[model samples]
Target: MTLGTLTWVRALDFPELLAPSTRTAIEAWVAVDPAVADAVLVTEIDPGLADTAALTEAYALPPAASANCVLVAGRREGEERVAAAVVRATTRADVNNAVKRLLDVRKASFLPMDRAVEESGMEYGGITPLGLPGRYRVLVDARIATDDPDTGPTVIIGSGVRRSKLALPGALLARAPGVEVVDGLALG
Candidate 1:
């Protein structure tokens, strides 16, 4: 299916693009919010081109239309807190300051690949906020939470696996369960 300027393959055709839990979450999301029923678009991609920089360049998508999800972990008292920070590819998430304060931890750093994969049930380079555990907080940078017509209504994000990518509206993402819009969440 082609919507506007983007071409999308049906998400159901590519099981590898979705983790089992993510598929469930997406189904539930669409079921509850019929308005965003057509918000998600899936496109086949080379696993080698999974990273935002390569994916955007190869697909002719502007950097502004690409978003990256990073998993960060911090320890406070006796518990560990982890969160997913979504930011545009051009900027970095303020993990040490904004995120740490948000998580109420002394320090926050990227979670180890092994732990992130084991816990999130997602591929290392493709861990999206869609299927994160309930305990995980999802922080969306303000730039992504606010849509811009010049960049289109959608941003390309990881599809839980490297073989495909999911293009979804920023507004839809902001409305996702557990997502919090954070201003100055990313460093300019």
Candidate 2:
């Protein structure tokens, strides 16, 4: 499948690229949302090249075309709050203040890799907001939600597996269930 100048395979073509939970989530989403189903595209990738810097360079895509999803967690008064924050790879999630305040906790920290992977049912480097548990708050940086004239309209995000990547319009991601478009979620 091709959307504009980008080439992609139907996400259904590579089920292995998605973790079980991700597959379930995508399937459920597609069933209820035809627009998203039409918008998403997936491509196979080398797990070694899955990291943002390597993937962007290897694929010849600009750095800003990539988005990274991070899992953040915090606790307050015996209650744990978790969020999935998506930001452009060119920037960093404001976990220190913005996210901490959003989560209503004193401090927010990246969830340990092992815990993140296990809880998200995704590989450490391939966590994505699309399939996160319902308990998680999906926070998307405003920069990522808007189309940058230089970066174009689409963004490369994880496919819940290190061996594949998903591409879709930024606006479409902002419409995903439970997504919160947050200004200044990312900072230089």
Candidate 3:
């Protein structure tokens, strides 16, 4: 749980520290996967430093340790489909090509910030995949979900609240709710 200039505690130990949805999801996940109990950690931080670059710089964390979750949506056959694309902070989601293809739509774009926050019930900069609605397809990039030990021991992601962040092994995060591992989900 040791990271940079931050102090991390077991996420479940302080449910009040997490967004309601995040707390519920993490609790449920832990019930089924006890192994994640200790691995899931949370640390409070200034909301102003929620951005990846700012956070890493302020906390002196490794840049690669942060992962970002972005929301993308497109309409297919008049029905709308949404996805949460997770990629390392160093890269961006392939929304124009790969995501559009996966969505089976002619176009894909980042969801509007207002709509994203309203629908997700999470703050704009703090939307994590842990508690997204079931309608959202969680897509994790291969680089972040890999079993390869050298990829990194852990990853830092949002905790469904801008005031804190969640830390856990990348492999464990890949197993969250309904994640689909896509090899080219991200563009370097």
Candidate 4:
């Protein structure tokens, strides 16, 4: 499978490439929607190049077709609310306003690295939307699924491990389990 400038293989055939929880979630999702196994592709890479910017540059991936999953959290009524914002690598998540409003919290900030990694059960640089704590809401930017010819149709995201990455149609990811597409979720 070819996505961006990298060649990937069916993630279903390479469960070892994904983290434990991520693989479980993908397997479960595939059980419900078998298409996921075929559509979601994975490829191994240098773990040091896992960061969005570094990966994009190293692999010649289109900036717009590469998505970043960021974990953000805030407290509302003493209850900690966490969310994973999936946005394009070219833009930033609107954490101050859009996210704060959506979360219904006075303020929002990036979840601490330790907490994010521990609770999500995924590596810090490889947090993907495929698997996350059930309590965490997934807020995908509206542009993620937009038919932008310039950006191509597929999007590359984390594989829950820094050594590999996953790619699939942005539209498919938007409809993933527990995902909510939100307009204005990204800031220019």
Best-matching candidate per TM-score: 4
- List clashing residue pairs in candidate 4: none
- Per-prediction tally of clashes: 0, 0, 0, 0
Which run of 10 residues does model 4 get worst, by summed lDDT? Answer: 145-154
Q: Quantify all predictions' global Cα lDDT against the true fold.
A: 0.83, 0.86, 0.88, 0.90
72: Cα error in model 3, Å: 0.6
**Candidate 1 overall lDDT versus native:** 0.83
Candidate 3 off by > 4 Å: 147-151
Cand. 4 TM to true fold: 0.96
Who is ahead in lDDT, 1 or 2? 2
Work out the TM-score per prediction.
0.92, 0.94, 0.95, 0.96
lDDT of 2 by residue, 1-188 (tens): 54333468767666777877777877887888966666777887779988999888777778888899999999999999999999999999999999999999998999999999989989977888888999999999988778877778888899888988898888888888789999989999
Per-model C-alpha RMSD:
2.0, 1.8, 1.5, 1.0
Stretches of candidate 4 off by over 4 Å are: none
lDDT, candidate 3, at 142: 82
Using lDDT, rank the candidates from best to worst: 4, 3, 2, 1
Model 1 lDDT per residue over 65-159, tens place: 88899999899997999899999887899998999999999989999899989998988778888888899999999889777656777777888
